[model samples]
Target: MCGFWRRYFFLKTLRGLRVLAYSPVTRPTIVPFDDFVLQEMMYAYKHPDTIKTDDEWIRWIFRLRRRERRHALEFVEGWSGTRIAIAGTTPWLASCLVGIIWSAARGNIQTAFTVAGFILTSSTVILAVLAIISSVESSNRAVT
Candidate 1:
């Protein structure tokens, strides 16, 4: 009778644990044990199912690879365009800055801080434009 009662309590506790494990509200936040992932992988590789997974796995891998390649190409394109635009425009901007700084240099002979401030402000704008272009390209979005 004692053994039977102990077994019954043990089973009841396990049943409760199973219920709690699957409950959305009461489910554990973390796994408490290692599932021996490598062992399962070795077993799966050794034991081929009637429904082959190799082809499916290969297709999935290829799909992911293509997606990554596409992202990389888009990133290069966006940056290349942004870089060309900035390069083409920067010469004019630099000349303008130099003229402004030269005038300031005549005034106080102290144009270092003014040049630094202008450079910093312009660099921030360029970086923001680059980021926006990259994000738009990656998302395949058109800016209206």
Candidate 2:
């Protein structure tokens, strides 16, 4: 009898917590997946440089092989750095999103407010470094 009463009281307390935590709000607006996909496809197709025909793909493949040969001959080619910048940005964006969600769940207004700013700052710094490196490389090529 004592064990059963203890368990019942614990469950009742948990039920009260659920009631206290209840948030009654209207449903959030959701974007239709089809419409979102359509928008992305349209945007990608609208870019002339990104749109590829079969012949264009073949030509691009050949061009890539030619560039590879040239790089081998030169032996001075270096990293593109775009991938590095993108890598840095990817984690920052993911962290910012997670932080936002965490702060929302915990109701931490300060954390939610500052997380995005910090992420943006790091992203900007990474992009700036990548841009400076690329620009220096381009300038060196022009000088040589």
Candidate 3:
């Protein structure tokens, strides 16, 4: 009787699994940007001839409303300086950790400190570059 019940339960579980495997996956619909500046950017991206020069692109963004200008600046920063800084520094940071670990494991405390200091100095330089980029971006926004 117990063996028969086990077979029955197994068949029920298999049928349930088969039903789940055949079910269609439902993905969330991705909605496009509704903002005027973002929509214009999309159109310009699709039709490159619309804005021909860097000056034209800058001027176009400068002409937008204050909120729109801020949004455009943020979007540009996300794709450019800020993104580059984080992506470039992340690997250096990971390597810094590994170097510190390796040196400490080898009982070379001084070497570990040296490696940490050098990487940290480079990180500071990268941070300075990021600061300059952000300041320039802010100045551009201020000019309009």
- Our model 3 lands, by Cα RMSD against the true structure, at 24.5
* TM-score, cand. 3: 0.35
Better of 1 and 3 by TM-score: 3
The list of candidate 2 runs beyond 4 A from truth reads: 1-92
lDDT of 2 at 24: 32
Candidate 2 differs from the real structure by a C-alpha RMSD in angstroms, to one decimal, of 27.2
Judged by whole-model lDDT over C-alpha atoms, candidate 1 comes out at: 0.44
Query: Distance from true position, residue 29, model 1, in Å?
Result: 39
Return the lDDT, model 3, position 120: 75
For candidate 3, the per-residue lDDT at 71 reads 24
The candidate that wins on TM-score is 3
Candidate order by TM-score, decreasing, is 3, 2, 1
Candidate 2 vs candidate 3: the lDDT winner is: 3
Better of 1 and 3 by lDDT: 3
Q: Per-residue lDDT of 30-52 in model 1, one digit per residue for the tens?
A: 32324564344334444558436
The positional error of residue 125 in candidate 1, measured at the CA in angstroms, is: 2.8
The digit string of per-residue lDDT tens for model 3 on 29-127 reads 222344674666656655777776758866754654353123222223223444455646775786588677968698887787677777777777765
Candidate 1 has which clashing residue pairs, if any? Answer: none
